[model samples]
Target chain A: MTEQRILHGADMLTERGRAEWDAAGVQVSALVDNPYKKDFPLLATKPSLAFLDSAATAQRPAVVLDAQRNFYESMNANALRGLYKLSVEATEAINASRAHVARFLGLTDADARDIIFCRNASEALNIVASSYGGSVLAAGDEVCITIMEHHSNLIPWQQVCERAGAKLVYMYVGEDGVLTEEEMRAKIGPKTKVVSAAHVSNVLGVENDIKLLASIAHEFGAVMVVDGAQSVPHLQVNVRDLDVDFFAFSAHKAFGPLGIGVLWGRHELLEAMPPFLTGGEMIDSVTEQAAVWAPTPEKFEAGTQDAAGIFALDAALTYMEGVGYEAIQMRESALVHTCMHRLADLDFVRIIGPADPALHHGVISFNVCGIHPHDVSSILDMDNVAIRAGHHCAQPLLAHLGIESCCRASLAFYNDSADIDKLISGLQHVWSMFHGD
Target chain B: MGEGIYNAALMEHNAHPDYKYEMENPTHTHEGVNPSCGDDIILSLRVVDGIVEEAAFTGSGCAVSQASADIMADLITEEPVEEVKRLCELFLAMIRGEACEEELEDLGEAAELKSIALMPARVKCAELGWRTALTIIEEEL
Candidate 1:
């Protein structure tokens, strides 16, 4: 018995080669199939099931799952409480995980001490906005965010402004979906208390120049806060190099467990700011009248921590590091380029954001002519290809573009060129069916 | 077939739609849209002598909705405008899995869409065409 061998060449894109390529691309068995993966029971019954909705919630690898199981099976004790062996072991493991995450993000041990665990990115952002609004921001102060921000990033600032009598300002995204340095500078004025922006636009896949934005915020004495929910998972991010005052992202988005988020702030800022949630673990000494609070990160983490989730997050980060961020970024960028080129050939398809791979990451949002995004998505589902539709929580940005919704195919490290081909073929079918051509 | 339930004929027709094109000029036109799935259906009808003589549907949607629309336009024409309304009511009941045996016969092939009740998300797609028919009939009335 002989095994079959697949070959690749430079002429793979040629017309004669395309048929073979397309066949290779669309054939379900040739690609990775997860029939036994019962983790997603909802997808079990789906006719043609391929999970491409990683941007919404990435599927957890087995290692991350094991890490969570191991945590509960062996080290099941509350952290930082008793002087017993089990308590000390749990506390050490939690702190070590924090240190590992800090190092992964280029933070020093002292800087890692400033990292606070929260429920998710939304809660983390609110912690900063609410705490800053109460302690630092005053009446007439301004909070600047970008037009491409997710509602998670924008709404908190809006509420903060309304409560503190501050104004929320937005920087506009140009036709290309990239915010220019001039536009960023113009938005951050003297009264700006905070300049919070997404490192990468989830909808457009446009990568913002964080270094320049941080510098502009620093020039105006405004604290630079970055929502790295989209960026941290796909790119190599260094908090120290960016010189950001605060940064936050969710574990689930990075292929970890859900309900766990990481908030990394400057040591000095975390030390100065008052705790957002005060409870058992966060207290230093409690009396009948008042209580002194624990320092920095512990003060912010008030109640029983998501110990299992945090451990799983550490495993996810370790898995990502093992894969190497540079390789992941390169792989995803190539996938995005292939997707853009394939989609560009279609007459009715319009690729949102910068079409160039250099200007963006793996996220690609587009619309087919005379076809609604939901229809496009549903048609793809029938073909066993999956994608995300609707405003993608960027309603304001979508409204600015005069579109109700657009189809988005976000790629991750696991995605390959075959996935792009599936999307393109699926889209073609959708277009032909809609136009009856 | 009773007036309230969908028949096997109607369900078959919905699965393989006929008369899914526009006439040279339509007496009435209406657009039916489903915001959830963003399914849109534009129905054009030509009524003569109190009868729907010709009908066509032009829109972008899923297979179920588009096929359902095609079937609806074909079945309703050459019938009394009043009976078309009764058929639309019966089709709605069929999709809800509430149409009795007599009602099912009135709905014809549209009754085949009872399988859609199992997939709750697809119920809207199955009903888009019937809803469009009702809209056009309502305007004429």
Candidate 2:
């Protein structure tokens, strides 16, 4: 007989707490079958687990974790604050990481200085909404965005428009999930000053034609802002190619350390906009009554930055580079295709976003007919299949789509067929658990 | 691994909640919302003097929220004011695993949701109706 272990709880879920493992290990017979699965420690340890919420946050690889530890072990100092060797090294690490991110996004080395580190994409977007929008926006002007914006992009503009006495406009999508040019033209008129959109929808997994949106915004003499939080992980997004005025993304969503986000703006725009935050190291010179701020990136990075997270982001970009865009896209496409086909096989399942699986960029949202997503999610959890079951922070989009909540299973290149199969079976189990009587 | 957790009492209460209806001009009403899960309920109570004349709820939510609302509405209706408050306190405490065996026994069928304390994610769902009921009647008392 093989020895087994029981994990106790003050009041363990009699059902879920029944996870018992034999001498080999916890659910050894049920470990996920994927080469990439081994790279993520959480997936590897929880072998039967299928994490399909990359749009929320992706799991970190060993290299990214090591990069964070190495930064603290070797040279953990405040960047741009001291002349000591350790501090200099920290500053250089941040500079190198910024350059790496710029190059990854196809920005010129000179444009590297335009990248500002913030808490996350939400904060990055808030900076633009406050500093840039606060400066350019005037009464009676209009700020146009899509009905499908994540709350991070939507709320900032909504509040900014309200504060500036400007009207907030929206570009609606058809049932096909595409924002037509006619709608764009109607909404983005001469009075429109800002046009912000998500490059990829976190809920729909549909890619918006941001290049076209940027051109139209430019035609109207408006600046375009792209929320690349969802796009950066799945696609090869080039900032210069898209030609948007500002771009924002978070590091944690790209398999990097937490609390690190990037906001890249045109150098001239960033230079003219007042600082979003005020503090030490962001100023060139300070007096009792007045202060001269530092140039570009440093002017925006006010407080003590996340030095270790910045250094670790360098590893994340390097890892993505090593994987190459072609391979990442191909692998993720196959996963999504297989998943969509299998889910369609279940008649009870109704997909929420784009009907075409090919159009999805590593994300899928659906609902089991007549069953609440929260209940669906709880049943799936019992089988160790994780998914997001809520409004996805896009209340406007959900209201527009006429759904209170949905189940989103976003994939990354690391996910494999075993994860998809487990998810399908878990969903079937959910259906039967509710109706098996 | 166990069977009783999902079937019968839980699923029946959710699928066919008899008390899920809007009360006409209720004596007290409150909207309970679990923002994260999108669980929302408008709990309505019709009270006369010191006794609850009727209790009902109208909303959408997960199985736990819907079932718990229906169950709580069924148990609290036609009960005295002070007795209703005691039952609500007992039910909430029982779901939280803080109430003793005797207090849990006083909770009637709501004690079936005791497992929710272990399932931390659903604790809010189970407490939605009781919390709303407590808040609506709290000021008057």
Candidate 3:
């Protein structure tokens, strides 16, 4: 028996099994020892850090940092302007970033033309609500959104509905954070002109069935808009397969830099809708009185774009592609399963979403009995375990769950079993601190 | 676990808060919410003949916030409304760690929350009820 085989102590093993155990030990040790502390330069300084807040924002890899630095140092110039070679390089880099995002989202060339780069997912959702839903939706029209939507998705529709004299219909989520097919059909009626829901709920961590929701919307002649912020990073999302009319996500949440977001809309809808924001690059021609807007994406991208950030975002997408969706999904699933199983052992830990980890992707929300989530988070922070606590910007959903707030431990591809162990210990500490055990 | 921000006095007040109940009839009731953590409270006061007759609070919050409100209610009851407002200002200052010994002594057990200043994130949690009391008193005046 080899050293690794003896250390793990599985069912009586052969020589070949011992060798495989040795190799597996090396791989797991790399993840357990360093976790994301090495891959992401941000955590390099904190050797024993445990970051379980990836649901808020992920730590960027060294490559993403290097890509941003390369853009600023080597090809620092304004994109889509100037005739110099440097300008052309900068512009090409931005376009390349767009192409990378399109390929990552599995969009075709025609669909790629409809992709609009905005500030963040909130801006992308606003673009749809203001430009498309605002102009087209008339009085008596209905906009359907789920109760589990973040305020970014909820408030915008509320504003649009009030301004247009339209009605805002809500589809309720079950106790398990799932919308039934019956609820989808019932809420989305003939008067429904737009249907918006998150592909995966940030707080609930439950992945919604976008294909089914889209089909229901299409039957009513309503366009389907998906908030892909919580889903795109953890899962393999093909926009074409989902057949969603509009999909919005933040680059920062997907291991990319901040100030860069993506909005993927149907080409036909982009052609029909007016521009969201108008400025220099967005105008094809201007004669003081009359200004002709540029086509599709350019008409929407106003002001100076974050070219360096876009380059970093492209690097992030490239890094994700290198890791591949299958590997990412498998790693995240195992980690979440370990977490759910362990948290389940603690009776005080009341999980807010689905009981099964398979229903979730990379996030878990729970609250400890007799301890406020804020207090729990504070105690955990003392142990160097970073977690998110509060309404998670889904107050309506929290209210529906009969909780004011919850403590969320979100994972990433870089996290491992060690991180989960640390979280469990931190939670135990919180309980002891509060309950005086 | 025994020490730090969750001190003995805070825990004592949180576990068996003397003033954590609704008043039979209140002249003023103010609802306060800390949107950050969802710490909410309903502070009710009975002011009659220019004197604070009774003060009570009912809420769900962290120990610091709920205990702080309970302590405030206990200290301010039966005092003149003007004196109650003065005590509220003193308590707020003490929690911010800006009050002198004489000012803190005026606040009674609420002065124990002076350590809250160290935890800036929780300063709001300790002051939600106090701020609500100020708003109610100001409206009455």
Give the better candidate number (2 or 3) by TM-score: 2
Calculate DockQ per candidate and list them: 0.13, 0.45, 0.37
Cα misplacement distance, residue B118 of candidate 1 (Å):
5.3
Q: After superposition, how far is residue A401 of candidate 3 from its true place, in Å?
A: 2.2
Q: How does model 1 fare in lDDT?
A: 0.77
Candidate 3 structure quality by residue, lDDT tens digits, A104-199 = 888765556788999999999999999999888999999999999998899989999999999999999888888999999989989999999999
Candidate 2 chain A, which ten residues in sequence have the lowest lDDT sum? A1-10
**Largest DockQ belongs to which candidate?**
2
Q: Compared to the true structure, candidate 1 yields what TM-score? A: 0.77
Q: Weakest 10 consecutive residues, lDDT, candidate 1 chain A?
A: A1-10
lDDT of 1 by residue, A363-433 (tens): 88888876667657766776678899877887778878777788888877666545565676677666655
Q: Tell the DockQ for candidate 3.
A: 0.37
Q: Alpha-carbon interface RMSD of model 1? A: 12.1
lDDT of 2 by residue, B35-133 (tens): 888899999998898888899999998999999999899899899888888998988777667799877777788888888887787889989999899
| lDDT for residue A110 in candidate 2, whole number 0-100 | 74
